[model samples]
Target: MTNSTLAQLLDPAITPRLVVKVGSALLVGKDGEPRREWLTALVAELAAARARGQDVIVVSSGAIALGARRLGLAKGGRGSLADAQAAAAVGQIALAGLWAELLAGHGLTAAQVLLTLDDLEERRRWLNVTATLGTLLARGAVPVINENDTVATEEIRFGDNDRLAARVGQAAGASAVLLLSDIDGLYDRDPRLPGATRIPVVRRVTPEIRAMATGGSSSGLGSGGMTSKLQAAEIAGLAGMALAIIDGQPVAPVGEALASGRGTLFMARPRKGARKAWLGGKLRVRGSVHVDEGAAAALARGSSLLAAGVTRVEGSFVRGDAVSVVGPGGDVLGRGLCEYDAGECARLIGRHSREHEEILGYAPRSALVHRDQLVLI
Candidate 1:
């Protein structure tokens, strides 16, 4: 990005569509209850965004913390992962209820969208999940998302909502992702050190800046720390979205960031559109196909997935499904919707598109996947 254009990123006139991930640590009080005022303040800022006609989604954590208090397990950590899952089971109700009530206070409705990583990694499910979030925002509803912890097995990951919030930002095509945490901003060292300083802005994510990060807990009852917040910033930045790790202690911190830009900002990397970003990055595949160097170069130059260059098909997939396209050396070039079934794909292998009917009785389309339907990895 042009160095002269940094100020434009901070302009409120841009009226960003945003995703705010509220850390569990920010919502807990000294007494360890959910801080009503802090939540209310966060809600008010989100409401302000809504008032300005910008969309907002809350990828919130705090269900276990809240449930621990309610279930009389506040001081206990002896439970197995299943035990914590059960605690989250109980806490999720309160989590949604409290968020819903707070939104209702602002005359807005909170629609809960609970998901597992399966929802994000599976191609069919990913599209549906984005559709759900999109519809909620379009209809003027604030979708408060949470991991379906009750059914999730991989609790240690994405449970922090750092990556989830990043995915949500990418999905929503958010202009910025605000990670509300206890710490005000990024520090050069642990905040406890005498000479440790707060870094107000991050122009680039250098390894030294990354080395400064250390682990922090979530609400004293959940997982996530300063390290995860920085990780979230990296994720958001990759999706062409700035990330603000602002103080979640003050009720008005969100407003403060809005008014004066008082937070650590990790600028976006000038991303492609949301769908392309999602398609290009992830979705674990059953197998892959290897292409020639010419195909690889063309793909690197932004060409779409096609038939002729595919030297081998690795997995069985139906037509119109997501598949990985790789170089013969085993580097993935991109992913795209397949035009032919795996059976047809094998027959059409290394053949030009115009040779379709001669080899196969019929063809779905001339192109294996249209440019718009393909995303370079």
Candidate 2:
């Protein structure tokens, strides 16, 4: 699709939710200070988005850069992990202050939220984060989110804000994610190459598309490269969220990019409900329940999976664990949280729902997997 066409499709007035990610390179100058003029223009765009009734969330990076400068550390390279952590400790204050000051000038409130990878990985923590963000947006506050760099170790770190923005978009149930970077968009070859060309729109991120990705961030101050952004695109795609990669150096970059679609737009798949998204993207399948043809047909009709339909259960799993639902022909149908353990499922296979209580010594639920917890692939 052409950029202009894509822009028409993603009219801000209709799209209610947006997540904008700004990299360190765009937010911080070579002197290790916030780029005030650029930020002021960006805030104006954010205000305009808010005026159109769009709930905007920002995933911003620049703490380390600012901190390194204040601490008199080397400018270009990420120092030791400890050094980076210290820099983050100091820079985060300056980062938050800059956002607060700039946003307040436009009559907008800024809320600082620091998150680690574990916040998204743990189900309870994830729910809390989502709830907090929702509450903030409901009250007309712009959330300025960043990785909790000071406390994060290598094992728990997201490493780049590209993937972090995608996760934030998914968690916030955003309609789209906008990654503002130094480059304009995805290129067919090395952008510096004479014959290289930009891809305006990506309908699907296939293996071939991934192969086009190159390593290393375009700007020396940032961590994510094109490869990480592509990875982020895949994550957002699976959650049925659109994403755009656009140049951030232009004046009123966010508004201009959306107005002209001057970037690479990744079209979202059909949107799914929150439960379905969690089932499809977050869970680890621990077992499989093979069903007969009749049961598979019933499932297609939106019926729950009863024990009578199950022919066999494979693997060990506890109740409430995610499991695969398979068809008689060995095709995978979907996934759901299993109501029964493996042994219990084995005993109840081919038995009617009425007999579940007698067979299992407890009448927990009629369906082995409730339709509410199931998500068809």
Candidate 3:
């Protein structure tokens, strides 16, 4: 946490892959119309970055706002979930058209991608998204992504696009994520108050730094505030991706912010692999497998956790869910995506891989927690 320059984060050579997020408030005006001029300028910058051989992805949030206007839903008024979904369905078309038209004007193809939280949380779906984004970039098309609000429920929805943008960056193996917002960057206190100063670089999201990210979104069109941005930064940081927050109200915002070093940059942690980082930083653990000392030592030696080494299984979890690997003395060692469900893991406990079929009626993956997926905390 210091006030210093980090303009290099925007360099294509340094950060070849970048994900930029534009909030609904920044993209849609009070009249519920797309801010065409502002978006055109942003698209021009993104096109230039792509022309420079940088993979640029835009995660824009404004479908619901635009849709709500078309549906005659009053601003700031509580609408039924069905009404919101319908609005999103209608708004997506207009949003996509606007992006396609603008990007085409710059001789760049635009790809519309809609995602739900499950799409990123589920392993197979996550891999599919990564592959799709990779293919799009390879084909020279910029992906304009948004959460699938129409199909997303409260349980499966990302409440804010900020966190969704961070996850998108992690899934795409991006080097950096830029959050274009209403504010310049994080401050020590409310910017409205005297003596409040923007902190330039955040090395970590500590409690003190979290305290500084107070206040809700100033624009009523968006749900994310400074707190959401900090949470997004933490997500990007853990995934070995730097995240920058800058005011997007200006023309050529990303370029201006970078040239002046006017935003807060959250430095990334050194990542062994994207999957390892994802495993290590999961917010919740679905279950845990307790292993013996030999298993713990084997894990430390970079070996997989075998079913035979597991002493106990706790909690109900499905395959691919994040599960904790516990040591004999009740110490939680690490976490990984489990290869089998909790019931199957329970039955396989203290059993060798060779005995897996006899116990479970089928032989599955040999390792309960593969070394590649496991990340020691």
Instruction: Give the residue spans of candidate 2 off by over 4 A.
Output: 1-10, 75-77, 258-260, 279-377
Global lDDT of model 1: 0.74
The candidate maximizing TM-score is: 3
For candidate 2, write residues 14-108 as lDDT tens digits: 45889999999999988888999999999888887777778889999999999999888885326788879989999999999999998898789
Residue 310 in candidate 3, Cα distance off native in Å: 14
What TM-score does candidate 1 get on C-alpha atoms? 0.72
How many backbone clashes does every candidate have? Answer: 1, 0, 0
Per-residue CA lDDT of model 1 for 1-377, tens digit only, reads 22323233334455357788887767755554788987888788778777776777889987777776777774532166666677788888999999999999999999998878778766678788878888888888999988877777763236578778887777777777777777777889888889988887786566688799988663565477877777677667656777778767776777665565556777767777766677654434545767888888887887766778889988988877778888878766667777777888888778887898878876447576677867764
State the C-alpha lDDT per candidate. Answer: 0.74, 0.85, 0.86
Q: How far is candidate 2 from the true structure (C-alpha RMSD, Å)?
A: 5.3
User: Per lDDT, what order, best first?
Assistant: 3, 2, 1
Model 3 lDDT tens row, 1-377: 12235665556788899999999988888888999999999999988888787899999898888998888987522277787788899899999999999999989899999999888877788889989999998898989999999998888888789998999998888988899999999999999999999998888787789889775988878889999898888778778888888989998898888777788888886665767866664556788999999999999999999998999999999998899898888767888989999999999999999999888787578698888888875
Measured by lDDT, the strongest candidate is 3
TM-score of each: 0.72, 0.76, 0.80
- Ranking, TM-score, top scorer first: 3, 2, 1
